[model samples]
Target: MIKSGISQIGGKYRLKNILIDNTPYHEYFLSLFCGSCVYELNKKKANHYECFNDKNPEIANYFIVIKKFFKEFEERRKKGPYTIISRYLYDLLNAGILTPDDMIEQAIQFHYKIKLSFASQLKFRGLIPETTSKKQFITQAKKDFKEAAKNRNRTEGHFKNSLGKTTRPISNNDCGILTPLNPKLEKRLKYVIIEALDFRDLYNRFYRSYYIKKGLTKEVFIYADEPYPGTEKYYGNLFKPEDHQDLIEICLNSPFNIMLSTGGECGIYLDALGDAGWFIKEVYTRYSTNANNQNLTKEYICMNYDIGKVHKMVMDNQPNIMNYVEG
Candidate 1:
């Protein structure tokens, strides 16, 4: 899967081993909290229409920008532009330059800063605006320097060198700039449909309309990776208890099939879903102890439809790694 350029919660790592097998009635697929997982799955499908979405605008825009300018970015990379661009941006920011009017330049700045920051958490979430403080800017710019050292592909965060060597920081060594420098296969996103809108709007209008209009033998499957309640949320988009209930209700009431991945829904969350015929299966993964290290954790996969009717949709809870490559 394309990394989607962010350190997402669970979608990326759960792709190969995820137990949800809810099939669509037709060739159309709906990735509710799309993130990076859907891209990998889409690459596998021969012919299918997909609606990939994330409720978070930043995440959505992340997908949208890559889809739009990846080709143009590729052309620039071929002409050896990033070495200059990456270093120039880095130097400008390190010197406490704050220019936001230039859109492309700003985008590129975000591209580099994000990769370098911890866990890809560079949204400036829960943080205040930038004052003209060299000290503050330098504090942030240091993260960019660190990212340059870990030159993982922009479409990926898994870093390892061919010679098992230390990744020395180069002048133009930003991960995002270096990423599109590659042939752009994993991140060849279809920009036409990727959007940054609220999921409720997408579901109520776009998806619902499509589901009604396109009545076929195949089903429409939605895989949502919503923020679990009571966790320190990413990007400042906190999920309330009622929000989870509403999401479950919406999925339960929809004419299509959906799979939701979340943490500890408790009786209030699951009982409502269970009463509406939803099934709960526990899926395990790792969360950090200090929020940076992986501590073994468990999340749930709730489906709105019954799998007993479908003879093949059966896989019990089995643990797997984040980077499991199926042989």
Candidate 2:
């Protein structure tokens, strides 16, 4: 499971409560960062000091402070950036100052303020890497900051669109299922699942047809395979099973009920959920009979199913069972 917390390094005040309660955009940003932090911390055993050695000590210390801060808020992990923000808003609603209606707009403004403040702090502390004659660290920082601003704007736009509309809270029973709020947006919910190795084209296709067009219903879900590690030279040793877990949680919790998984790789998580009595539905992508093969027919079999349906398929198509992934 992923951990959560609040920072003690930064003082907690009424403003923090108001900011968290009122701002939807900031909530989204913080949730994304929390997911990313979970991926990093779980994947690497090293402390922040060791992992961020390239950064200034003060900058690294700030990250340590952040890590500690979020550690206090670990129990409430929700899906999607919006839902994550909503979780914080819900907490603020308990504090008796802000109404649920005020959250989305407040969260957006707070998110922008946090980003700007953090960036300024980094610059003020000289923690942002100094530019060299050959390498332009300052230029890279500027580009990254611009990108961050752009993404924040996009999130803010989405949050603004949610105002004046009431969103029904999703229940635990609706976990794996998609529920449409608007009938007109239903078509955007159809999704195609592909191996992470085959993700390039599929990602482009999904973004162009669904995400970019803004045609997606709140219910449409994408189930993507996790990418294979070591595909990039710089990231060779950086990938880990936990990183995939973080990615899976992010997708599972998104505005659209999209899901991404490397089916086999996610077995650990699935098994854990199953042990917790969560209902798991197994969908077979392919099949092969060879028992010794890593990707085999039996492995794809549903744990919840008895011998009836699967046995019938196996008996009817013996040849199909031999069509395992090529070694």
Candidate 3:
């Protein structure tokens, strides 16, 4: 469980909440980047635009306006698709039905659509826009997609080199190398680790370290070729909503306390954990540099036991613990 006040709206710990809510979807489009940043920065309660000004005012303003502009564009586009909107706005400007500023806004909206469509096409195959009138845009989109696909394939080939000849999906029983726990936790946790590795290599490393610390053996690992839903398949399988739901159910039903690592991956898991009524306590990571360090490295644990009491204790006795974990 997380400590008391850890989830408060201000301070270093606040970004965790932002990451949990925005990362999977917000990272794809540039316009929504500021909203994601604002949420992570704990400025969601205040004016979304103001959050950006607290650090980089100019960039923040740009993002804020972009977000607003996109919202309006979306509303207007509901009457038609981007091509129709572009034509109508252009005609409106030519006929004096729209002002100069309106024309510019419409153009910006069109530009945003072009950029977004091009990026999406490049990221995923079979995404070519059907109504883009500009041949240049289509050409560019195709080129970009091919290049991106090439790069992604290259990266995947490299990662695949690291895994041995275990081509089939790993079964729960084959994951005995993971930390031993209640049978329920063991089955579910192993699957989580395996599924996470399908998205992030670093997550696999973290899980490996976690199991080692718990005195579990290592097992053969595998990655699913297809992307998980709600995320681009390019980076491997995206973390799905159902994945989170499963995790929360497992954690809530568990007999022992749950521990989570800190980072984007863990943040995703915490969303479900929060929904399931688990709170976080202290966050710890094994250190390798300190002389007293147990030489254990690549492990993080967020203890969920007595989260409220532990949080209060840390707040009173060690207010700096937040800084420690935040850093």
Write one digit per residue (lDDT tens) for candidate 3, span 151-250.
Answer: 4434545533222343332222211112121222122112111111222343334344534454332121111112122333322223344554444443
Clashing pairs in 1: 24-218, 24-219, 25-217, 25-218, 25-219, 25-220, 26-218, 26-219
The local distance difference test score of model 1 is 0.54
TM-score of 2: 0.21
What TM-score do all the candidates reach, one by one?
0.63, 0.21, 0.21
lDDT of 1 by residue, 45-78 (tens): 4145666776655555555556666665445434
Give the runs in model 2 whose Cα sits over 4 Å from its true position: 1-216, 227-239, 259-261, 271-279, 283-327
Error of 3 at 249 (Å): 5.8
lDDT of 2: 0.29
Clashes of 2: 26
Overall local distance difference test of candidate 3 = 0.31
Alpha-carbon runs more than 4 Å astray in model 3: 1-205, 212-237, 249-303, 311-327
Position 166, candidate 2: lDDT: 23
Question: In order, what lDDT does every prediction score?
Answer: 0.54, 0.29, 0.31
Indicate which candidate wins on TM-score: 1
Clashes of each: 8, 26, 11
Worst 10 residues of 3 by lDDT: 24-33
